[model samples]
Target: MEEKKMGLMKCLFVLFAGGVIFLLLLAIYPFWLLFAKVTNLIGVKGIRNTSGKLQTPVVFYEHSVTKRIVAFVAVIHIAEPAYYAAIQELIDSLKGYKILFEATGKLSPQEEQALTQKEKDISSQFDFIFDLMKKINELMSLQYQKDGLTYSASWINTDMRLYDLIRAFAQQDISLIKKGRDIDDPFTEEFGQTVARWFINKLFSRFIPVGVVLSVVAFFSRDKRVAKRLILDARNEIAFQGINEYLKDSDIVTIWGAAHLSGIEKCLKKSGFREVRREWFTAYTVRDYSLFDAIKKGMRATKEAASAATALKKD
Candidate 1:
């Protein structure tokens, strides 16, 4: 009888240990995404606020008591950088649902190459602009290193490029800027200087109306409000596209900033989704380091390691 009792106790101990290990694994599973979001240095957290009410983290789903639609939402707030693996996990989880990502537009091949060159080029004339942008990105990265912070450098670049593009269009000699025939310069006397202004404005607006409008709006209006409007419009389009393409035939999942999703959630609610759910996904935050800051941190760590090694040698 004593031997049998000892055997039973041993079996219980093994089972308890296994259960504890499994639980710990499950808890830390979300951290694995640190590689994609933080390591790659690209990605945003989805977060939003609307109607004076903050959207909290809650999983939304729809079921009809006896049946389920198998649809759901998993929101990743971009306040903190997201891991690429987290994105993959999000895609896998929502594999049952259609996926829509609210993000900055992709750079044109030429634009991307140009931007890369701009970063690498050592130009005395453009150093001021280069340093300004580097500083801005560094600061932005640091702020976003905080928990619940999501950001997209792509969005920042896009806005800057669009503004620059439109300004160039507005200020350049349009007829001659792109190897086109010059408009009769002699006609300026007939129409007056106002004609020149009107002609340029019209040309700029017609070429890329969105940028033109945004530029003009920005000149007179606050920047954040304009960005919010643009993001809202983009969110609506993404949601609509997803619903139209996948709602009836397949499931969908979307990744975007939390702020953008408030608009999307509203769209989903109005579109007859009985229940909308959200899940708060988290990853370790990285401090946004400036070029200087990164260098400093590296040197500090190296010095510490060297000091420890010297101590060991003396001992």
Candidate 2:
């Protein structure tokens, strides 16, 4: 009876350990898949180094029949100043190439001032998100794209208007403004807005990494289809249209967010463009002090301390 009990307990312990390992792998699989997809889209083979530094890529595609070149300059919104400088230098080198850049509903000062109250309110909500992004940039010791890159008057904007985006989201029954609101709450829209603002303020105050926060927000969003359709598909279609209409047989240079590149690449491939060259740029290096690094540092400190003690004894 004792032998049988021992065997049963061992079996149960093995099963429990296996279950825990399976659960851990299951939890990690989605993140690994996402990372793989992102790297594939941006033409990055291995994004991270041993030290946890990440690199992004810029891909160049050429039309098969026309032989015209199109350079897709993938960019992060916030990165080291040197990254933007390298991008600017690349743009300067392509002197005659027409630049197609990404900016949605950018308004002139006069146009901004003339917006109606509702429009102003909607704009302010978007501005709040941008402000949070800027705060994150500052927290990460990174430079904002707007400050880092010089914009040219000649570059074309291949993005939709803010009102158009709102309409698209509304069609999908997704309210961008009320996105964070509690559905069970019995309150006015103003109350919801206030609560949302307070929540965002608290969230940003914690100084969480922007990428992690964005991934969490995306994962928790109620309508993922809406985001895919409006943010990625529709925007990509507009960019494709701009390329077709404006970039007729000219060596085109596009500056867009790295996330948007996959969709744009699909469109380009369908239009006879194939990726010819790829270059990786180091965006930022996060210093991850691993166990080995910590041990090395501790040993150096101990050696220094011992040397100091020996000198004190000699004195």
- Candidate 2 overall Cα lDDT vs. reference? 0.69
What candidate 2 gets wrong by more than 4 Å, as runs, is 1-51, 106-125, 176-222, 288-315
Model 2, 211: alpha-carbon shift in Å?
A: 7.3
Best-matching candidate per lDDT: 2
Residues 153-229 of candidate 2: C-alpha lDDT, one tens digit per residue: 88888888766665456556554454333332422233333343344333322222334446577776777646667
Candidate 1 lDDT for residue 229: 49
> What does candidate 1's lDDT look like per residue over 1-315, in tens digits?
999999999999999999999999888656633432342232222322222112223345443442234233334332224433444555465444544444333345665455432232312223343343343333334212223323333211112233233223233312111222223342233232234334433332222233334546665644334444444554455555655455566555444444344565566655656564555444323232244444455557667777888999999
Q: What lDDT score goes with residue 170 in model 1? A: 30
Error of 2 at 311 (Å): 41
Error of 2 at 295 (Å): 20
Best by TM-score: 2
